[model samples]
Target: MSALGVVGGVLQPLLVAAGAPLLVGVMRQVRARLEGRAGPGVGQPWRDLRKLLRKEAITPRGTSEVFRLAPLVLVATTLVVAVVVPFVTTDSALDPVADLFAVVALLALGTVAVALAGLDTGTAFGGMGASREMTIIALVEPTLLVAIFALSVRVGSTNLASIVASTLHDPARVISPVSLLAAVALIVVIVAETGRLPVDNPATHLELTMVHEAMVLEYAGPDLALVELASAMRLTVFLGLLANLFLPWGIATTATALAVLGGVLAFALKVTLLGAVLAVGEVFLAKLRLFRVPELLAGSFLLALLAVAASFFLA
Candidate 1:
């Protein structure tokens, strides 16, 4: 990679780490306003995270090192993904590691770490949450991979930068049937992966119904802050990848200052619009019953399958 690419590696994660919470805050604010009340402002997540950072950490009486280390692993892996994805500039020193499979595996690493920590906690809620989260991961991963396959088949390269570069050079691909199908498949994976509505409620404390929250329920202080921030960064990274891959209109192809600035603006606008779309969706839909979630995920797999087929056939 060039020096410019090296610079991008340092800058991309900073973008994700600093800006991710704002996306969640925006979504929450939108959701609240839609319910006909004044909502927590867009800065709410940052404030909540700050509060968690100042509190005391409360570990359970009989937990192992896994419980203590899992949050760090989760946050670390997500930051790696944030830097590796072509969120700001397609040319990045990390491009060699930005393969579609690698990105998915990085995400899976965090999930696995968190799941093991959940099991390590020895709480019924933790076990229940781990079980549910794993189930969702199983269902979500195939669709995610296949959706990547659908997109990658077109360019013959699974590299995130290559995919974005291809899409950027050919703006018309955004509207193709394969792109549309893959987009649908990915949007479903995003909702599932992010613990958004119709899958898991991020704000709920209800024991039986919560998935992600249940796993992290025992965490406090900096650990909880890291976990929350990691969640936000992961969601933002996923959305950034989605926007850059499918609608790569303003993604910086080069490492130039002006181009990068434009890319940042484009990235913000796209994710903000997408977040609004998600919040609107949450308002209209109810969470699926636990038993019915497999059906929802299975449907996602089918959509991804169609996307792959369409990519091959349409070409």
Candidate 2:
């Protein structure tokens, strides 16, 4: 890799970590506009992070060390995942260790850590949220894996960079029915995994309706900020994968300076459009009852399975 390419790889995760909260802010603004209400500015999430960082951490009396360490683990895990996923191009520096399966495993590890921390707080709400989160992960993860497998089968590898490269080599892959179905499955997975509408409401402070927020209720100060930022990063990572993998029209395959710039611009445009679509979906759909979550995930699973089968048979 050239010096610029090396520098770009080093900066990739930081850019993703920073871009995530901004993405969430933009989605909120879009949703507000769609609902005919005044919206917070796109920089709102940044302000929140700054404020949270300046506050003091207040640990629950009954909490264990896991509670204090969870945020750090969460943030680190998310950064690792961000590095693994190719946003602007298919030549990530971490590609050797950034297999699609490894990415999923790291995500699961973070999820488990956060869930255990939630239970460690000894709060009924926290435990309940943890239970709900585990349930959702159990249902959603398989769908995510299967959808990825659909793409992997077509490319003959489980590496995200390879998959993106292969897709770029054959532009016609974008319009395949299997690709479309996988995209749909991934969208549903994104909404559910990111704690968005019809799955969990990020805006809600109500304990009964909160999944992610409830789990982090005891976290404060920088710890809270880390957890929140990690959640935002998770959203960005998923959307980036969805965009770059399925519709990687403008992504850079070469290490040229001009290609890198174009790739960055293309990445921004794809993420912006995806965020807007998510915001619109949230505005139109009501949050599903917690019990109904299983049904929604089940539908996604079936679609993903069909997608995999179709790709195997057709692509």
Say which candidate scores most in lDDT. Answer: 1
Candidate 2 lDDT over residue span 1-315, tens digit each: 444435457666877887888998899899888878898899999999999999998999988899988888888888887766778767777766568889888888888889999999999989998999999999988999999889899888999888888889898988898888888999999999889999999898797799988899888999999999999888888898999988888887677878878878888789989998888888888989999999999999999999999987895
- Minimum summed lDDT over a 10-residue window in model 2 is located at 1-10
Kindly report which residue stretches of model 1 are placed more than 4 angstroms away from their true locations once superposed: none
For residue 293, give model 1's deviation from the true position in Å: 0.8
After TM-score superposition, the amount by which residue 172's alpha carbon in candidate 2 deviates from its true location, in angstroms, is 0.8
Q: Indicate the residue-level lDDT of 197 in model 2.
A: 92
lDDT scores for all predictions? 0.88, 0.86
Candidate 2 regions exceeding 4 Å error are: 1-8
The residue-by-residue lDDT of candidate 1 on 1-315, one tens digit each, is 876566667877888888889999999898899999799899999999999999999998899999999989988999888777887777767777889899899899999899998999999999999999999999999899999889899899989888888988888999999999889889999999989989998878998679999899889999999999999999988888788889888777777889888878888899889988999899999888889888988998999999899998998
